[model samples]
Each structure stands twice: as C-alpha cells, then as structure tokens.
Target: MTHIRKAVFPVAGLGTRFLPATKSVPKELLPLVDRPLIQYAVDEARAAGIEEFIFVSAPGKTALEDYFCAHAALERQLADKGKTDLIERLAPTRMPEAALTIIRQDMPRGLGHAVSLARRLVGDEPFAVLLPDDVIRAPKAALAQMVQAHARTGGHMVATMQVPRAQVSAYGILDCDEDAARGRLLRARGLVEKPRPECAPSTQAVIGRYILMPDIFDRLERQGPGAGGEIQLTDAINADVETVGVTGYAFDGERFDCGSIQGFVEATLAFALDRPELAAGLRARIDRLAGNDRFAA
Candidate 1:
C-alpha cells in the first residue's frame, strides 16, 4: 500500500461564528492557550508521519501562510536578549522550506470544494484531511491512530466518535458495522450528511479527520450540491462506499469543537488546566469562582 505522506488543511471558511475576532484574523490563527488552532492540527499530522502540508485557504488568510514562516528579525531579537528558552519554543512554528504549499480556494463552496482544490498538490497518493476546528486531545493523536488503521485496511478511513443521538444531525453520520478482526474499526456501509435525528443511521458521527484515496477527487468533481446546498464531502465519500469502501476508526480522545464560542472557551480552559505551570493557580481561581455568589444561577 502507498504511504500517506501528504495532508490537506481546509482553512477557507469565513468563521462568521467568531464575529469581530475573526473579522481581522483567520479563525485557524486564533490562539488555543499558547499555540494557534492550526498548529495543533499540524502537530497531529506530523505525529502521523505526514511529510507534506497543503493548506487550502482563501484570500484574506495570508496570516495563516506567514505563521509557518521563519521570523528572522524576531529570532535575532530573542538571541540578542539571551532568551534561549523562548527561541526554543519558537522552533516548532517553522516549517521546512519545501514541505509547505498553500493553494487558493477562490470560492467558499464547501468542504468538498476546498479539498478538491488540493488535487494537484496531492497528486496520485493517498492523503489525510484535517479540519482545525475540531481540536482533539489524546495520548495518541487521532490522525496517527487512523494512519495505523489505514496501513492495515487501506481504502478510505474517517475518524469516528459517538455523540448524543439527538446531535447526529450536526455531523456526518455513519451507517456501519463493527470490523470483527479489529474491534475499534467499523466497516462503513454508507455516509449521511447532517441527517435529521429520526433518519440517522447511527450515533457514530464523522469528525474532521480523514484518510482518503486520490480517486475521491474524481467523485468530488462529479458531485453536485448536497446538504446545505454545498458540495458535502460526506456525499462524495458515500458514493464510494460500494466500490472503494470506507472504514471508521473510533479514536480515544477528547474533542472540542473550537469553531464555536462555547467550544473555544471550553478548549482554552481545558488546555490551560493541562499545563503544569498554570494548573494550580487556575484550579484555585476556578474553585473560588464556583463558590462566589455572584456566579450563582
């Protein structure tokens, strides 16, 4: 089987949910604790052995491109100040010269359309697609787990997580059966894009992570508008179920939908609480706030 070396990040969304904050800054550049949202997704891709990074972005997202570039002036300032620790912290933000590619998605058609724009960069190899909105915290990165599962099963794979039955309409629902050999892997029979709760096939909803064969571009090209009158990636993947086959890997992780204000704040608190330096103080503040009558419902 071909190795999955390339990964695509679709960052073209307008991020209207974030209002004034996203008006000037791309949503992917929003800070989660210290690192930007896109950084976490990139880190996860690196953990999965993804060598090439392709970002499908829109016109106003130049900041996203600059974030991964080397800041020589800042580096020199840090060196002059003898801030070696801070310099070391900046290392991961620098991307290798030839490993990064940014493509323009001229229209805000949909996720499928954004991904389709990366075809030339991805070429004929299998690739991974990660949406920065879904920040997943796990001992083992979700994409890494999917990469391992893909190596065993090939075809196409998606990250699956169980959500409340009532919330299935918010995500791409999977119609699948358990893989007998691999308990955590599910053989997807079909995919439903944002189906109503009454019509949902299962509670296992597809998250942002995906491992797809290059042939998916063809299906996407022929695909018309689906749910929400946009080209839904779920619909394209569904079209391949009978032939190429899709697998669902139930990843062990805590996922935060950072696209919304509530999820973003929740993720910020969760990540801050994970840091040893901030944990004790944050815990005390949280405890104090909990007991304050001003915060009473």
Candidate 2:
C-alpha cells in the first residue's frame, strides 16, 4: 500500500451560521481556545505523517494562507524581549516552505468540488481529507487512527461515529456490516446522503475525516448535484463501493461539531477546563453562574 503524504482541507464555506463574526474572518481561522480551528486539523495531519498540505479556499479567505506564514515583526519583538517559550509555542504555526499549497475553488459548489480541486496536487496517491469544523479530542489523533487502519485494509476509509437515530438525516448514513475480525471497523456496502430517519441504512454517520484513493476524483468530476443541489462527496464515494470497497473506522474520540454556535461554546469551555491555568477560575465562574438566581430554571 502506498503511504499517504498529502491532505486536503476544504475551507471555502461562507459560514453563514456565524453571521457577523464570519463576515470578515474565515471560519477556520476562528479560535477554538488559544489556537485556531485550522491549527488543530493541521497538527492532526502532521501527526498522521502528512507532508503536503493543500487548502481549497474561496475568495476573501486569504487570511487562512496568512495564518500559516511567519510574522517576522512579531517574532523579532518576542526575541528582543527574550521570550524563548513564546517563540517555541509559535513555531508549530509556521508551515515549512513549499509544503503548503492553496488552490482557489472559485465557486461554492460543494464538498466534492472543493476536494476535486486538489486532484493535481494529490496526483494518483491516496490522500486524506480533514474538515476543520470537526474538532476531535482524543488521546490519539483521529486521522492517525484511520491511517493505521488504512495500512492494513488498503482501500478507501472514513471516520465514522454512531449518532442518535433521529439525527441520521443530518449526516451521510452508511450501510455496513461490523467486521468480526477487527473490532470497530465496519465494511461498508453503500452510503446514503442525509437519508430520512426511517430510510437510513444505519446510525453509523460519516464524520469529517477520510483517507480516500485518487480514483474518487474521477467520480466527483462526473457527479451531478445531489441532496441539496450540490455535488455531494458522499455520492462520489458511494459510486466506488462496488469497485474500490470502503471501510468505516469508528475512531475513539469525542468530536465537537464546531460548525454550530452551541458546539463552539461547548468546545471552548471543554478545552478551557482542560488547561491548568484556566480551569480553576473557569470552574469557580461556572459555579457562581449556576448558583445565581438570575440563571434560575
């Protein structure tokens, strides 16, 4: 099996849900805690041995590109102040020269179109696709787990989670059978894009992480508008089921859907509570707020 080297990040969405805040700022640049949402995804891809990073972005999202570049003035200021620790913390944000590539999507077609834009950069090798909106908290990065599984299975793989049955329509549902030999690995028969609750094949919902073969680009190139009148990535993957075979790896992690306001706040509080410096004060504040009569149920 060929080792995965490149990863594509589709960051072209308008982020309408965020309204005023996303008006000028790309959603991926929004801070999850101390770091931006895209930072976590980049760190996760690096951990999984990805060497080349491709960002499929739209117009007005140049901030995403700037975020990964070194700020020389700021660095010099920090060095002048002898803040070595601060400099070390900033090192991870800079992408190595030529390792990062930005491609313009030019339109808001859909996930399939965005990923297809990276075909030339990805070439014929199997590559990973990571959606920054899904911030997964895990002992092992989610993409790394999928990479390990991909090494053994050597086909298309996707990170999956069992969402509530009622919520199946919000995600691409998988028709799969649990692999008896390997726990948590599901052998996919097909995929349904946001099927109604009663029509869903299973509760196994496809998440944002994927390790897919390059042949998928061909499918996406020919695919028509699906579901919400856009070129759905699920449709292209579904087209490969009979020929390529797809596997679902239920990753061991707590995924925070940062695409929504509620999930963003939940992730912020959760990450803040994890930091020793902020936890105590945050906990006290939470206690006070909960006890206040103004917040009474």
Candidate 3:
C-alpha cells in the first residue's frame, strides 16, 4: 500500500470572479462562514491522514501561506485570557512546524501547471490534490472516502458528483463505465474538459478532489495548453486513462463552489444551519427575510 502522506493544494489562480474583494486578499482566505475557504479543504485533507501539506501558490497569495502558520501573539492572548475553547479551535489551523511546503507558481498557466509545480515535493508516491474553491459538507470528508477507494483499487481516484446535464460544460466531465453496484466508485474510461452539452460523455462531473499516482506528473509535463489556451488538468488525467486506470468516487457530500458568488452564499447558509447554536436564530432570520415584501421582486 502506497501511503498517501502528502496532499497538494493548488491556490495559484487569480480569482477574477470575486473581483474587488479578491484584489487585495487571496480568495482562498475568504470566509465561507467563520473559517476561510482553504481551511475547510485543509481540514478535509487532515482528516484523510495527510501528513505533509503542499500549497502551490502564486505571487500575491502571502495570506494563504500565513494562514497555516501559528499566530503566536494571538495564541498567547487567548491563552492568557482563559479562552481555552478558542485556543482549542485554533489547533486545526496549526501544522507541525515542518509539515508545510509552499511552492510558487510564477505564471497563471492553469490547474495542470499548478499541480505540476508540486511534482518534486510529491515525487514517486500517490498523493491527493484538493481545490480549496470547492467546499464539501458531508458525514465523512470526501477526500477521506476517495483515499479509502484508492487503497482498494490502487489507481487514480477522483471525487465525482452528478451534476445536471445542462451544467455539464461548467465542469470536467467523466467518461466512465457505470458501476453495477450503484456505489460511489466508477471506472473512468476518459475525461473531457468543459465539453459542450451535446458532446458530453456523461452528466457525472469531476469535482475538486483527486487522489493521483506520481506518474501523472509525466503526462502533465507533455500536456499542452488546452480549452482556454491553458494546460487543463483533465487533459493530463485523460492521457493516463488507458495505462493507469482512473476511477471516480461519487463522494457522499454536498459541494459548495466557493469560487462563485452564489455557491459561497449557499455554503455559508448551509454551514450556519448545521450549527445548533445558530440554527434557530439563523432560520428565524431567513424566514423573516423571505417574508419581506421588499425581497419579493
């Protein structure tokens, strides 16, 4: 069993969608509720037993790097004030001093390019790739589930979700043999990046989570700029389809596309409702807002 001790987080993209707000702050640091978007991804990866966290970052993403580092002053302040609960909550954000590696992606090439940046750090092992933009809520972390699937199947594993056919073009669509067991795992035949609806292989879309073998670096190295004239990760994965075998695990979860405005709002509300302390209050406020005549338009 190849132990997946490392996980790569590609956070190099300039978030044009969030615009003005993302202008100064790294979009990964943007809060879904109280926690930053990247924190959720990190938590999921941590739960999956990942030991070393590798962040592929861009020039302007200093805050994203700082997020995982300890804030000594703040920790001291909380400790001195007897805020044990607050300090305990901060434990997840702190990594063992040597466990984090931040690599720079100098250009905005694409997701594949960003992932390739981590090749040296992840050499010769199966590792996971998590896109912080997609925040998933589930009983078990989605990547944790995918890791277990990879342990059993010994191949490339990607987290998948069934999106509506109309929305197929927005994601990397998987071409796969349907599982007779009707379980989460699907044997992938191929993958396409943002294909038109009529040309789509299936309505099953690949989400942000992926557990890949090290040889994927070889495919990504030879890959050319695709789709939007940027190297597409889907293309690289497809390149290895025949040789390594790719599997899509339909992860049990609800994914929130925090990279988009609507999805960010949805994730915020969904997480808020899950908190028992805030559920009733948030529900009352939501009901009041819905009943407001001003919002009816």
Question: How do the residues 1-297 of candidate 1 rate in per-residue lDDT, one tens digit apiece?
Answer: 228899999999889999899999999999999999999999999999989999999987899989999999999999999999999999889999899999998988999999999999999989999999999999998998898889989888999999998999888989975435267798988988788999998889999999999989999999999877888888999999989999998998999999999999999999999999999999999899999999866
Arranged by lDDT with the best first, the candidates are: 1, 2, 3
Better of 1 and 3 by lDDT: 1
- The digit string of per-residue lDDT tens for model 2 on 122-239 reads 9999999999999999999899989988998877898999999999999988898654426878989998888899988889999999999999999998899987788989899989
Per-prediction TM-score, please? 0.97, 0.97, 0.96
Better structure of 2 and 3 per TM-score: 2
**How many clashing pairs does model 2 include?**
0
lDDT of 3 by residue, 31-100 (tens): 8778999899999998899999999998868887678889999999999999999998888888897899
Global lDDT of each candidate: 0.92, 0.91, 0.89
Consecutive 10-residue window with the lowest summed lDDT within model 2: 176-185
